[model samples]
Target: MAKEKFKDAEKGNAVEKEAEDLENGNANADAAVPAPLYPKMAEDPRARWAFIRKVYTILASQFLFTSAVGAVGAFVHPIPKFFLSGGLTSIVVFVAILLSPFIAMFPMLIFRRKHPINLVLLAIFTACISCSVCILSSFFGVKAFLEAAILTCTVFIALTLFTFWAARGGNDFTFIFPFLFATIHVLLVYLIIQLFFPLDRIVYTVYSLLATLLFSGFIIFHTESLIKRHGYDEYIIAAIDLYLAGVNLFTSLLGLAGIA
Candidate 1:
């Protein structure tokens, strides 16, 4: 009887051990299995490529638009002068000049989101500026026009190159912005004062020189932003706005330098 009882207890112990081993095996197996990685949770590989293509297209459009504006300005240069008198000329130029920043930004206003319209607007703006200069020069006298153009172009180019050098050559130009703005505002106030007086012929010249410097900074600043943050979607309008600013600045500088 004793032997039989011992045998029964051993049997029970063996069964329990076997059951535990089975449970352990199951637990190990469950732990070994990996969860499925859902494709939908991640960004598609093709999305990046599509964005890159769109950006390239936007940039291409900007180049094309800028060329078109330049052509238009050149074509318009030979037309007979439209208006005269320093007051009338100044008013037209002022309106156009003041309107420029707004015009350049028009695309941004329309898109309700950032897009390439800014680029294209910038290009158109540049063309308008060149045309304005050409027209002013046509009436102002050929010699004066040429002289102004030369001056404007030279100053514009210099500013661009200098800014580029600073950007690439290791100077952080972002810090200079406040100084530039302050200087510009002071000059603008002076211009307003001169406008009221009309007695100082020299004021316009000083204003022109100041404007040349300011616009040069603008070109660099705009172009830098274009390269950095504006992105592919903003190219078209950005280009137009920049182009306008450039041409307008150049022409205005030319006009100021040329006009008596």
Candidate 2:
């Protein structure tokens, strides 16, 4: 419980830092802002590919690392093959994965690092903790589990693409805060219920779709805020928040897809 609160605090800090950037307008970070995070658009074809490359690199690394974690957990987990079928096992696995963003975000915020290798160990453990839930759930059926895992990965990919798209173009998806907040509030309540009750499959499906949409908007919104609009010259923290958003979105999608 304390861990969750800490994680939430971390997420809040990310937003606060971005707001600071917007208010202070520190010209020092101008170079790091890149094109999408830039206050104004500049014609840079390389910027598009650059963002693309970074995103794809993260996506690939995240999945491979996450899968490895799941595999390790499956071996040492001492849990039953029917763990995700229902009962306490499902609840345990479900809640752990669902709250993973909060878990990872809390620590990542306190000390941000630029180089991926600097935090590779932490990222691996975090991925294992979260992905273990998905892997255990998959034990119910390989095909079902794969679909869920793949769907989760797909949402993260979508978010990365959306961020890049928002950067390249002028669509400005930053205006969806009200709806996003409301949706997240509702989703949280709904998820709490699902932890104890049997939610309708249709509801899960709708929530899944909404999760993808919400997180995609978040990527575009946060990326723009941190660079061009918001003031997270502390790119390390900003990256952590964005990564959390992506990972949580993937987790949500996996839940829905697994049932589908």
Candidate 3:
């Protein structure tokens, strides 16, 4: 009985020692592994990919609708004439066009997560933006619009590809956002000053070049944010970010070409 009791005590010690070893091993292993840079990204891969697909799909739809409206405004003489004709109706339409985005945007933000309502708001926002694009394109004529469209598409594709490659290589671009914000505000102030002062053509050219570069940076920044900072559930916000960047790029390109 004494021998048996001693043997049992030895067995218990061995088992306890094994468990302690396992616990230390696990701790060491965990310590060796790096923490995820984006915790939300560590969710299911399928969900993340699906989110990207949805965002791009929505963005494509937005571009298509804007392009269509732009075509109508540019090619259809009656529409542009009606809008550009100096009258109370034209003035009202012009003001409405300028204000439409803000009107739709606020409601969209409020209902961004509310399913079909959010979708409705998104459509309204897209239509508003489309109207603005259409009006701008109408001023530029078909040839200039087409040229700007081609250039914008090229720039957008290149930037998107570069963004993906840089992301894969572990580059981060979120840091540039503050600089971008400051620069945009400065540009807006400059734009307001330009409106009052009527700067030279060379100055306008420089301004357009700077704006193009700025919006290009926005494309890179926003695209990377989509891959890194945004979660799967923020597809609406992501789509809007990319769409705005695209629209701004086109407008800047138009200005760069001296067509706007």
Measured against the true structure, the TM-scores of the candidates, in listed sequence, are 0.52, 0.59, 0.82
lDDT of 3: 0.85
Encode model 2's per-residue lDDT on 1-260: one tens digit a residue.
Answer: 99999999999999999988876776655655554443365545355445545544554566566665554544544444445468886788667765775666656655555465436644744574556554554443445446656765666566656765666565666668888788889888888998899678788788778877777667666665544443323444445556656666656665665566
Q: Kindly report which residue stretches of model 1 are placed more than 4 angstroms away from their true locations once superposed.
A: 1-82, 85-108, 112-131, 237-241
Error of 1 at 8 (Å): 66
- Rank candidates by lDDT, best first: 3, 2, 1
In candidate 3 the C-alpha lDDT for residue 176 amounts to: 88
The true-versus-predicted C-alpha distance at residue 210 of model 3, in Å, is: 1.0
Order of candidate numbers by TM-score, starting with the best? 3, 2, 1
- Error of model 1, residue 153, in angstroms: 3.4
Model 1: lDDT of residue 133: 49
Which candidate has the top score in lDDT? 3
For model 1, residues 28-87, the per-residue Cα lDDT tens digits are 986765321222313332443354345446544543544344444344544433333446
Give candidate 1's whole-model lDDT. Answer: 0.56
Candidate 1: how many backbone clashes? 31
Candidate 1, residue 180: CA error in Å?
2.3
User: Which model scores highest in TM-score?
Assistant: 3
**RMSD each, Å:** 14.5, 19.1, 7.2
For all candidates in order, the CA lDDT equals 0.56, 0.61, 0.85
